[model samples]
Target: MKLTTTSRIAGSAALCASLALAGCGGGSGSGSQAQGQIVDGGTFTMALNADPGNLDPQSSAASALFTISQLAYDTLLGVDPAGGQIRSQLADRWSAAGTTVKLTLRKGVTCADGTPLTARTVADNLTYVGDPKNKSPFLGTFLPAGARAAADDATGEVTLTLAAPAPFVLNGLASLPIVCAGGMSDRTSLAKTTAGTGPYKLTEAVPGDHYTYAIRDGYTWGPNGASTATPGMPDTVTIRIVENPATAANLLLSGELNAAQVTGPDAQRLDKAGLFAARTAAVLGEQWYNQAEGRATRDPAVRLALTQALDLGQLRTVLGAGQATPPTTLAAIEPLACPGGTLASALPAHDPAAATEALKKIAGKTLTFAYSTAGGSAATATAELAVQQWKAAGITVTPKPQSGEAINQTLFGTGDWDIAWAQVNVNSPDQIVPFLSGPGVPDGTNFAGIRNSEYDAAVKRASAMDGTAGCATWLEAEAALVKAADVVPFANQQIATYGAKARFETPGQLIPTSIRMLDR
Candidate 1:
C-alpha cells in the first residue's frame, strides 16, 4: 500500500549506460529528466497493467487508479524533484502547525468544467476523503482519520484540523488528489471519467481497454509551477489496459507503446535495446496475514510459524526472477525518508522444525493464500512456490488467485483471505501506519485487521515529532511488527519504466507534467 496497490514490477531492471535510441543517450536519473532539446505535438501511449475499474480519484489508492489519477487530478502539494522538500501545486502557499495545516489556493485556477476552484471547494474535497462514512481509501492513509477541513473563499485558504498530530502530513497531502465539488457531489460521475484540476482531462473512457486524456489548455498550476503549456508535452495521452507483460514489452520494442514499466524476463532485452527508462525502487514481495478473529492466522504463533516455514531468500529470488534485493525497510519509494536497516533483526529466521511443531498443535485447518494476478508471471510463480513451501511445513494452503480488484475486495470487503502477498509501496512511513494499525476494512483502509500495540504506540510517539525527526521510532515500529510476525517484507528492487521515443518522470508513478514526447 504505499495499498499503492501498483503491483510491483517482478523483474530486475538494473541501470546500465547504453547507446539507447538514435538521438537519446538517456537523461540521467530515471532518464525522464529533460536535458537537451524537447520535441512537441505527439501522443504518449502507456500500458496500464490493469483497468482502474472505478475512476474516482479518492476511492482507492490502488496502483492502477493512482497512476491514472496523477494524470487527471492535481494535489495541493507535490514532492519536489530534489526530494524531501514540499512544493506548491494547487495551493501556492501552505504550512502546518501542530495538528493544523493551511493551504492557500492559487488564483486563476479553474476546474475542467470551467468552474473556479476556490479554497472552499478544495476544503470540501478534503472533508469528503476524511469522513469515515464516505469509505474513501485515503481516509486514514493520507488525511488523518477524523481530520476535518474548513475554507474561506475571501481568504483563499483552507484550514485542516487533524484528530491527531501527523509527522508526514504534508507528504501525505502531496499524494491526495482533489476533485471538483460537482464530481464530489455526484460520486458516480467519477467512476467513468475524471474531474480534477490537473494538466490533463479524461476525454474518453473504455473499461478493460484504454482511457484517453487531452491536455488542458491554459493550465498553469502544476507540481512546483509545472505547466501543460511546456513544449514537448504530449497533446494526447492514452493508457492501454494491457494485462500481459510480454505483450506490453513487445509493444514497447515495436514502438506501439511509447512507455511501459517492464519487469518481466523482457526487461533485460529492453535494457539492451537502449530504451530510456524512469527507474525507482519498489517493494516487490510483502506478505500480509489477516489477523481477524476466528482466522487461523489470528494466532501469533501460527503467523510466526507460517513465516518461519518458508525460505524467504528463495522466495525473494523467485519473486524477482533472481534479481531482487533484500528490503531495507517497509517503505521502498525514494528518496528513503528513513534510510537505515530494520527488517532483518526483527524477521523470524527460517526454521522448519519450529513451524512443523506449531502446525502439529493446530491441525485440520487450511489457509487461504491470495495474491493479485496483475503482478505478472513472476508473482504467479512466487505464489505457487510459497504454497509448496507451506505444504512442506504441514500447512495446507489453498491458493486464491484473483484479479487485483477482486483481491482488494476480499481484503477490504469480504475478509476472505487468510494470507496475502500485497505490496503497499509508499515513500513515507506515515502513509503505511494506517494499514498496519487502525480501524479494519469496511470502515477504514486497515484491510488486514492488524492490531499490534507496539506498532500503535511507536506510531503515536513518532507522529508527535516533526517529519523524519522521529525516524528511529518510526523504523522501530516497523521492526516491532516484523518481530511479532505481523507482516513480512522480503524483497525490494529497482523497477524501470522504459520509454520508446518518449521521456517522462516517475517519482513514484508517472508525473503527467513531466511527460515529454521525443521525436525519434
Candidate 2:
C-alpha cells in the first residue's frame, strides 16, 4: 500500500494517446456548456470498477479504498501533485530536526462525530498505525517502524520520534489518513462508517453495490486550504460499482454517469465521443519471483533465466497496445520523488540464448506461475505470452489464473506461487524500502521473499541523505536489485477517467478535494 502521487492535471495529448483514443474534445452534452460555471447543488454519480473490500484505510492496500477514504479522513500533510511538495492539511505547520518531527494542528478542526480534533488524537492515530501489534499494513511502509508520538493538548502540538531516520518521513505522513479516536478504538466500525475531519460524511454503504456520502456543512479544513463551501462542490456523491468498462462508458455518454474510469477499447470510444478525460501514469507490468525456500524461483539462476527469456519489447507492445512507458523503477507513478534513468542500464536485456544456457542447469524443473485477471484481457494475454516464452526456454510453467483477491491471498497468505505478475506503485523510492529489504509475507509486504544485503546496504546509504540528494544512490541501489533479477518492472501505462458533467484531479487515484460539479 505504498502511497503514490497526488492528483495533477495531465496533458490532453498524453491522455488521448495513452487510451488509444483519436483526439480529445468535449462531448455533445451539457458538459461542454458547463466548463467554467460552478453549480450550487447536485448529486454526482461516479462508477467504480469494483467494490473496495474494506473501507478502513489501515487494513487494506487497495487504491480504491485510499481514494474514497480521503472524503472522511485528512492527513497531517498534503502533497502538491505537480511537484511532490508537502503541503499543510490537519497540521498547519511542521518542522523536522534529526529523527524527530513536530506538527502543529490547525485551529477549529473537528471530526465527523463533532469531536474536536486535538494533538492527542493525532498522536493516537500515529501510535496506533506505527504499532506492529495492530497489524496495520501501513506500518513500516507508510509509518516508519518503532515511531512513538506524544501530544501537548494545550499547545496543539504533536511530536513524533522515529527509531531510525526516515528520509521521506513527511511524504509518508502525508499519506497516512488520520482516523478519529472513536474510529481507532472500534476498528470494525471503520469498515462501513466515516469518522474523520474531511468534508464528507458517509450516509449509506451497501457492500458490492454503492456507497453514498453527504457533504458536511460548514466544513472548512482541507488539503491546501480547500473547503466544502467551494462552488461546484457536490451536495451528495454516489459511488456505484459498475465493473464493465463498456457499460460505464455508455452510461457516461448517455449522461447517466457523471464520472467513471473506463479502460480498454471502450476508452477510445469515449474519447471519440469527446468526453473530458483525466490521465495519470502508473506501473502496470511488474514481475516478482518468490524467493522463499522450496520455490523453483529460489535459484538465482532460474530467476535470471526467467526474466531474460521474455521479449520485453513485444510483451510491452501487447500489454500496453504499444503505448507503455518503459519502467524506470517501482516508483513509476508521478510526481516521482526521485527521478532517474536507472532502467536504461539496470533492466536485463532480452536474450533467449542466454536464458536457454542458464536453464540447462535446471532443465527439468517445473514452476507455478500466477497472475490476476483484474486487468481484464490484457492481463490474461500477457500471462499466456509469458508462458509460451518460458516453455520455449525449456521450463515447464503451470499457469494459475486467480482473481485479484485470490492472487493477494496466494502471494501473501499461502505462498503457493513461484512467479507472479504483481505491480507495486509508489511515489518515492523510500516507500518501497521495506518491500525490498525487510521481512516478507505475514510479517511484511515483501511478499517476494527477496533478501539482498547489498541492496539493503545501498538503501541505507540513500536513506541518510535528503530525498532529492539521494537520487543517484537510490538509482544505483535499484540497479543492484534488477541486476540480481529480484524483480522485473517492464511497463508503465496511463490510466484515464472520463467525465460527462464533472472534472476531478487524477494523479493515480481521484483526489477528493478536486472533485467539482459542472453546471450541466
Candidate 3:
C-alpha cells in the first residue's frame, strides 16, 4: 500500500518561519495575582504550546498540562522519585493483599472548597472512574474490573478491592486526583474545578489558552517523598501557551519565561547557551494508522513494509542531539522492555528495495497521514525522510498537519486516516495495552484499531504472570500486532526536560504538578 506524502508537499512555505510569523512567540504573560497565595513570593510561569484536553483527569489522556495538574491537585498516591515506589498523599499509608487494598487517610486535610478530605471522597473518586458510564479511557488499564471502594468517614479509612492482581495500580492511582463528593455527583462540573487535597488550587483555566493556579496554604497532605510543601515559593503558577519552540527559546534566553519546551535545533541551541540545564526521559513514538479507513494500512503487508522501512537512527538524527534514543521493541527500552517475537520478525529490514517490492504488491493505493500537535522542524523533517523512503517503494503518501483534537478524532474519534504520527505516554511497559489487545478499540490511546483474539489472550496471560514469563506473553502479542500490520512503532522517543535557573528537583516522570521549587 502506498503512504500519503504530506511533509514534502506541504512545505510550500517555510513551515517554521510561517509558524513564528503568526504571533507564535515564546510565551505570553498574564496579569499578576493578588497577595498571599500558595506561591506567595514570585509567579512560576510555564509555557506550553497547547492547553490540556480537559481538566477532568479521567477524560483526558497524558499531555503536558495533565502532568502539571498533579501539583495543583492531589491524588491518593503518587510515584516516589527516590525509589520509584508508590508513596502516600491524602492517604497516609496503603497496603494491598491479593485484590484488596486498604488506605489510611490523613486527618485534618480539606479540599479547596472547605469540605473535609475523607474516606468517602476517595471512595467516590475511585468509583467514578471505574463506572463505565463515565467512559474514562484510563479506568480499564489502571484499575481492575470489579474494583470497589468502602469508606469509614469516622475513622478516615478507605479500602479498595480489585478483581485481580494489578502491579501498576499505584501508577494509575497517581493520575487520579481526588475530587469532592459534591463535585463527583456531577462529573461534568468536577472536570473544571480543583477540589482535591493537593498543594495548589486551580484558580482559573481558559481553554485553548492558559491556566492559573495558586497554592493551597491549608494543604499539608502531600507526596510522601516531597521534602516540604512550602507555601512561599511562587504565589501564582501561570501556564502560558507558546506553540513555537524558537519563540520559546528566545523568551527563555531573555529571562521573560521560567520554563519552556524547546524542540529540534532549538533544544540543541539551548544546551549550548550555558543558561539552563537539561534532563531527558524515555517515551513511545507511535506510527499511527487508521483501521476503519478501509485502506491498505489495515492489510498486514503494508504495515510490515512501513515498520521495516523506518530507520530509527535516521529518525533520531532528525530529532537532533539527545532528543531520543533508538528503540528495538515497541515498549519503552527500559527495565520492563519485552523481548523479540513474531512482530519483530515480520518487520522488514530498513532496505528501500524490499519496501519498494512490498509497495509494488499493493500498488495504486494511497495512504493518508495525520500528525498531532505542532511538529517542530525535526519532526517535520523526519516525516519528510519517511516520505522519501516510502515513495521509493511506490507509495504516494499525503501528510496533513492537524490539531491534536482533529488527530484524536480521526484515530479514536472517527477512524478517518490511513496512517498518522502520534506519541503515547509510558512509565511502565503495561502502558502499551491499547495497541496489543483485540475486539476492543484500545481505550483512546490505540490509534491502529487493532483487534486480534490471540494478541488479546497473550497480553492477558502475560499480565497475570511475572518477570520474563509476562514479558514473553507481551512479546508474542507485540509480534501478533506487527504480523497483522495493525500499528507500526518506529521509535519510542525521549522527552527533553530543560532545567531553568530556578532550583527544583525534576520528577522521574515529567509530571509538572509534583515539582516543588527551591530557592538557590
Candidate 4:
C-alpha cells in the first residue's frame, strides 16, 4: 500500500466519525493472552452498549454502527496496530499520489450473496458515497469528499480521483465499510440485512436485543489477508445489547459472555477477575459547548467560564474512576496516526471565582446540558458533578442524561442542547474538520455551529503537508480549538474489551477476524 498527499497529509485524519465515547481513539493492547487451548466453532458473544438503529454502515459515524460494521463489512485497506502502517484488506495492491488513488482487487473475492466481488462494485461504492446528494455520512469521514471513481473490470482495478488532497486517504479507506452490489441496489434493505464481502454474514437481526452472524467460508481477505477458515475461529458472532456495564460484567463472569467492554466501577473487579483483554487507550471524557445562535454558550466568555467552573482534574479522576489519564488530542481512538499534541496548555485554569463573575451575563438563564448515558454510572456522577460546579459558579444549567441513540438525535437532529458530552472520535485531526468548522446542523455535520477562525486557518496549512511532516501545524490547529474553548477534552483511559473464554484485538473497534474462542 502506498499513500501520499501533498507530500501524505501532515497528520492522520481522525477520518471516521465515531459517536461512541469509549471505543473511539488511540491504540494499544494489554492483559494476559492464550490462556487455554484453542476451541473452534463456539459462539462468540460480545455486549454492545447500544443498538445501532440504522444498519446502513455508510450512513452514520456512530460508534455502534462502526462496531457492528466490522462483522459484516470489508474496507479497501487497513492499518497495522503496532506500526501504524497501511495494510491490505479487500484491495490487494493500492496507492495514492496527490489526489488520485488506484486499487487492485484481489481475485476470488465473493460477497455474502454468493456473487463474485468485482471492480465495478468497488467503484460504485465509492461513487455512491462520494456524491454529496446521497448524504452518506462517510462522504468525507472515510471516503474523500467529491471523489470520482472508474473501474477496469478486465484488470480488477478501481481508480479514484479525489477532489481534494487528503493525508489519511489510505487509512480512512480502511474504515469505509464497502457495500456489495446487492446491498447497493437495494439500499434500504441494508437497514435490516447484511451486505459486503466480509468474513461474516448476518443471520439474524433483532433490534435492542441481539444481532447474530455466521462466519463465511472460503473468506481469506481480512486485514493482512486474515481468513475465516482458521481453527478456533468462531462459527457464530453474537452482539447483544446490554446497557448496564455492571450487568455486562456480571454476564462475563458468569461464563455467559465471551467478551464485554466493562468501564465504570465494575472494571475494577473485572480486572481482578483476571480475564484476557484487548485494551485501547481513548479520549472518553470530553465536553462540547454549542455556539449556535441564541445559545448562552455561544459567547466566548460563557464557553470559557463554563469550562473554568469545573475542575477537569477532579472530573477526569471521577469520570474515569481515578484510572484515567490526561487526554492528548481531540482524536480519541487507538493506534493514532499523528498523536503529537497536548490539550493542556490551551485549556483554561480552573477558577471558580472568575467563572462566577464571567457568567453574570446570563444571570438567571438555565442552559440545557446533555450527557451520554452509555458511560454508565460514572458518567451520571460526572454530569451531576458538572452541574454542581456550574451552579456554584452562578450558572443555572439543567442536566439531561440520554441514551446513546437519544444523544445522537439531540446533537445531530434537533440541536436542542447548550452543552453535550458527545464526541467525534477518529484517528486524525483532518477528519475532525466536518464537525468543527463546517456549516451547522440541517446543512452540514458541524452540529455545534462552531466558528473558530484560528482553527480553520491552522487546519488549512496543516492539511497541505504529507504524513507527519506537518505535525506542528496540525498540533497548532488542535490548540486553536481548545484555547478558544470550542471543545474541552478532559480524560483519556485504557478502554478495555474484556474477554472471558476468548481473546480479541481492538485497534479502534473490535476486530471481528481477530476473535478466537478458547477452551477454558
Candidate 5:
C-alpha cells in the first residue's frame, strides 16, 4: 500500500523544441546536469502532486515535500543532496562524549528576516521539538530520551545531553530545519511560508496549487558541503501541483512545464515522443500490517503468509515503467544498500498455494488490510491491486481509500487498523533498532507496534560495531524482525525524475549537504 506518484519524464523531441522556443537553449542533455545554470531572473516552473500538510519542522509529516522546504530553510546540519551523507550547515563543529553532544554554531548567521541565528534559537528549536507540551509527532523519531538542550549564547554553541548513548544523534539533528522563531509564532502560517536561513527563500505558497522560492540575494552562509550561493538557476522556481499522469504529460507536451514527473503508461508516451530523459532512484516500500489491533494479522503466521504471497514481479509490472524494483534486502537500492547475504537472499517468493494453506490455519478470523490513497490515484490503484492479489490466497483484504492524513491519523494516532501499508526509511542499520526493538523506541516511527527483546539486543550490537561487521549484525536483526513478521517489506520504490529533453538535467533527490540544480 506504500504509494508514490513521482516519475521521471525524459528525452522528448517536442520538449526540446519547446524549450528552444521558450529560450531555455536547444541542448539535448537537459536531464544530466546537476547545477542547472540557466542563469537567474526567469521563473523556474516545477510541479508537485500535492501540498505538504505541515511546515512546523517539528510537526511536519509530509515526507515528500520536507526536502523541498529544506532548500528554503536551514537545518542544524545538512546532507549531501546526491549522497545523503551528514554535513555541517548551521553547526560549525560537533563532538560527542558518551550521551552528551556539543555543537558549536557558526557566527554571524542571519535568518531571512535578519534576526541573528543564535545558539538560544538552536536550543529553542530543539526544545520545541522535544517538548511534550508541543505534541509534536516528529518527537517520536527524534529526541527519544531524558534529553536536555541548552545553549551558551557567548560561545554560540548548543549542547545536547541524552539519557542514554544514541549514536544516530547527528542524523536526528540533521533533520531539524531552522525557521525564523518570530515568523513561527503562527504555526499554521509557517506551513505556507517556509521561513528559514538557506540559499533559497520562500516567496509564495498556495496550498494544493503552487509554491514559489527565490534565491536569497547576497546570501552567503553555507557549511562545508555547499558552494557559495551563485544565484540559483531559475531566479524564481514555481512548483505546479499536478496529480494526474496524463494531465502532467499533456502540460509537458504543451510546453507549460519545464520539468514534470511522469509515471506508468505516461512514461511510454513521453519516451515515444523521443524528447525526455529518465533517472531512477530507489525507495523502500512496505506493506504495513497493523499487529497491535485485534485482527487476524496479529498472528505472525498470517502476516508471513501475506508477505510470501506478494509477487514482486507482478507488482513491478503493475507499478509500470521506472516505478519500482524488487528489493533484495532491507536497504534495497541505496548505494550502501546491503543485500543481507544469501540468508537474507532467501526472501519468500510469491507462492499462492502456501499462502492459501497459511490462511486456512486462521480460517475463522476475518482480515481487513487497510490502506490510504490520499496523495493521488496511484496509491488507490495500488491498494486495490493488493486486495485482489491477497484475495487469491484465500484472504479477504478490504482495501479502503482514505485521505493520507486520515490514514496516518488512524495508524500513528489511534492505532485503529488491522493492516496498513507504508514505506519505512532504513537508510542505516543504526536506525533499525528503534524500528524493531522494545515497546516502540519511544517517539519512534515503528508504528507496527512491535516489541522484541532479542531483536533489540541485536540492534544495539549492530549499532556499536564498525564497518561490515555492523552490517552483518544488522543483517541478523533484520532477519529476526522479518521472521517475527514485525514488518513485511515487499518492494523498493524507484525515484523517477522527468524533465524537458533540452531544458536541464534532472538530479534524482537533491542532496541537502550540497544544493545542486540539475542542467545548470
Candidate 6:
C-alpha cells in the first residue's frame, strides 16, 4: 500500500501556510481572497510532461499511465496520502486469514456503463492480472504469483487465495486498478476507452494532445469518504501533454494551465512567484545490469568492478544538484513500507584501484550503456560521467540515448543492452520482490537475470512475517544482493509539482478527490 512520508505531509503543510499567507495579503473586498471558499463549475487544466502511452492499466507500468489511469478507475482499496493506511474504496471492508483474503464490495457502486460493480467483476480483474500470458507488468509486482480469485455473487464477497505467503497482500490489492467486465473482455479498446467506477469519466481523449474527463455526479464512494459532489470540485478536468518543462511553466504563468510538475531552474522561478508546490522524494540514480548471455555485465566480478569504479558521492552531488539524499533501498519513495539501515553498510565502496584489479581478467571488454533522456541534460551528463568512470577501470563503453518510451521498449522488448539506468520507485518493499528475486525478463520482472538462492530464501522468510516486522529480514536480503553488485542505487531527490490559478493537495501526484477550482 502507498504510505505518506513525514516529509510529504510537511510539504503539504508548507503549501497550505503559503496559501493562507496569500489570503491575508490580498486586497480588501476581493472575492478571490477568501480562504477555503468553494467555487464550482469551472474547468481545471493540467500540464503533463509526456504523452501517456496507453490508458490501459494492465498493459504497462509507466508512471504516466498510472497517473492518468487514476482519473477513470478505482481500486479495491485506497491508500491514504497522509498516512499509508489502507482505506476502503470499492471494498467496504476486508479481512485476511492465512494466505486467503476476503473483500466485500461496497453497496450501490456502478461502472461508467451503468453495470453494477459486482464481486465477480473484482474476481475477473484479479484473475486477469494474475495470468502471465496477459503480459501485464503488474503480474508479480502488484498481483501475487499463483493467486486465484473466487466470487460469491449472492453475498457480494470475493476471496483471494495465494499460492505462497505474501506479507503485503493488502497493499498489493490496493495498487491493482479494477477493470469492468466489458473492458476486460475487449482489451484492445482499453488503450483509448475507459470503463471504471471512479469520480470522473473519460469523455474525450486526444492522444499526444489532451484528455478530458467530466465529473461523475452522485459518486459518494472515494478515498476517505470523498465525493464528486464536494463543493469547489471541478466540473471538468483536462490534461494537456506538454513535454517541455519550461513551456509548461510558461503556460501556468500565462493562466492557460492550472498545474504542472516541473524541475530545474524553472521550479525555482515558480517558487519565487508564490505558486503552490508539493514535493515527493524518489530515487533518481539506479543502474541495472542485463545478465543475459554474452553480455559483459553477466560476470559478477565485472558488475562489482563497474560499481566500485565510480565515486558515488560525487555522482550524487552532480546528478542531484547537491540536494539528493543517499538512497536506502529500491523502495526509497515515501510512506516507505520498510525503512531502516539498509544502505549504510550494504553498498560497494568507491575504489578505482580495486575496480581495475577486479576487471583485470576482462580488460578492454566493450559494453553498451543505455539511459533515458527524459530527465533532460542532467541525466545525459550523469550517463557520460559513468562511462568515463568505467573507462578509467579499463573497460570500453558505448553510450546509447533513448526517449522514455523508447527506453521502456528497448529494456523490456529488445533486451539489447548490457547496462541501463532507470528509476524503480515503488510504495513498498514487497512491490520490488519480483524485480529482485524471480525469473528473468521475457518471463519476470527480474530484468537483471539474477538468481541467488540465498537471497530468495531470505525473502521467503521475510514474506511470512507481517508489516514492519519483516524490515530486518528484507534489509538483510537487499544487502545480499548489493554485496554481490547486482544493482546500484545512488541518489534520491524531492520532485516538486507547481500550481497557479488553482489550489489543490498533492501527496505524490494530484489527488483527484482533493482538486479544487480557483475563483479566477
1-520 per-residue lDDT for model 6 (tens digits): 1111101101111110000000000011111222445678689898765556678866766555666677788888866655677779899989877788999999998888888899998999999988888877677777888999999989999999999878778877776789988898898899898989888889999988999999898788877778988888888999887666668778988889887766555666676776766566666666778888888888888898899998888877666656767878766545667767457367899989999998888776778887755555556667788899989988888988765555666666799888877666566777777767777767866766887777788888888888779988988887788788787878777666666656765444456777777665
The root-mean-square deviation over C-alpha atoms between each candidate and the true structure, in angstroms, is 4.9, 5.1, 7.5, 4.6, 7.0, 6.5
Q: Which regions of candidate 1 fall more than 4 Å away from where they truly are? A: 6-37
Model 2, runs deviating above 4 Å = 1-36, 360-366
Compared with the true structure, model 6 gives a TM-score of 0.89
lDDT by residue for model 4 (104-218), tens: 9999999999998999999999999888777766666677777899999999999999887888778778778889999999999999998989899999999999999999999
> Model 5: per-residue lDDT, tens digit, 132-165?
6666544534454457899999999899987767
Q: Give the Cα error of residue 454 in candidate 3, in Å.
A: 4.3
My TM-score estimates for the predictions, one after another, are 0.93, 0.90, 0.83, 0.94, 0.80, 0.89
In model 4, the runs with Cα more than 4 Å from the true position are 1-34
lDDT per residue (tens digit) for residues 1-520 in model 3: 0010110000100111110000000111111111112333567776665445567655644344344455556677765543456777777778877677888887787777788877887888788777766665555545654689889988888989888776556555654556766667676775666656666678888877778888666556665534224534566777776666677778877766666655568776766765443233333244655655456877666777776666756765675444554444554322333434334354445766677777786788777777643446666777777777777668888777665444545655666678776654344445456434532343444446666677778777876774345766667776666556565554433334443434333342234333434342
lDDT of each: 0.76, 0.72, 0.55, 0.76, 0.54, 0.70
What's the count of clashing pairs in each model shown? Answer: 7, 1, 17, 18, 35, 3
Where does candidate 5 have its weakest 10-residue lDDT segment? 16-25
Tell me the lDDT of candidate 1.
0.76
lDDT of 1 by residue, 1-520 (tens): 3353335111111111000000000123444322435788688899866667789977776677777787888888877645467778888899898889999988999888898898888888888887778887677667887788999999899999988888878877887888987897799999997888888899999998899999999999986678888999999999998766667789998889988876756676777777787777777778889999999999999999999999999988876777888878876677667778568667899999999999886788888997766566777788888899889999899999776656666777788989987777766787777678888877666778899999999988988888889999989999999998898988876777888888877777778888878776
Q: Which regions in candidate 5 have their CA more than 4 angstroms from the true location?
A: 1-37, 81-85, 140-144, 183-192, 223-232, 268-280, 320-323, 329-346, 361-366, 371-384, 402-406, 413-416, 432-444, 466-469, 501-520
Model 4: how far residue 205 lies from native, Å: 0.9
Weakest lDDT window of 10 consecutive positions for candidate 2: 16-25
State which candidate, 2 or 5, has the greater lDDT.
Answer: 2
Better model by TM-score: candidate 5 vs candidate 6: 6
TM-score of 4: 0.94
TM-score of 2: 0.90
Give the per-residue lDDT digits (tens) of candidate 2, residues 447-520: 78999888898888988887678888888888899888898878777766778778877655566667788765
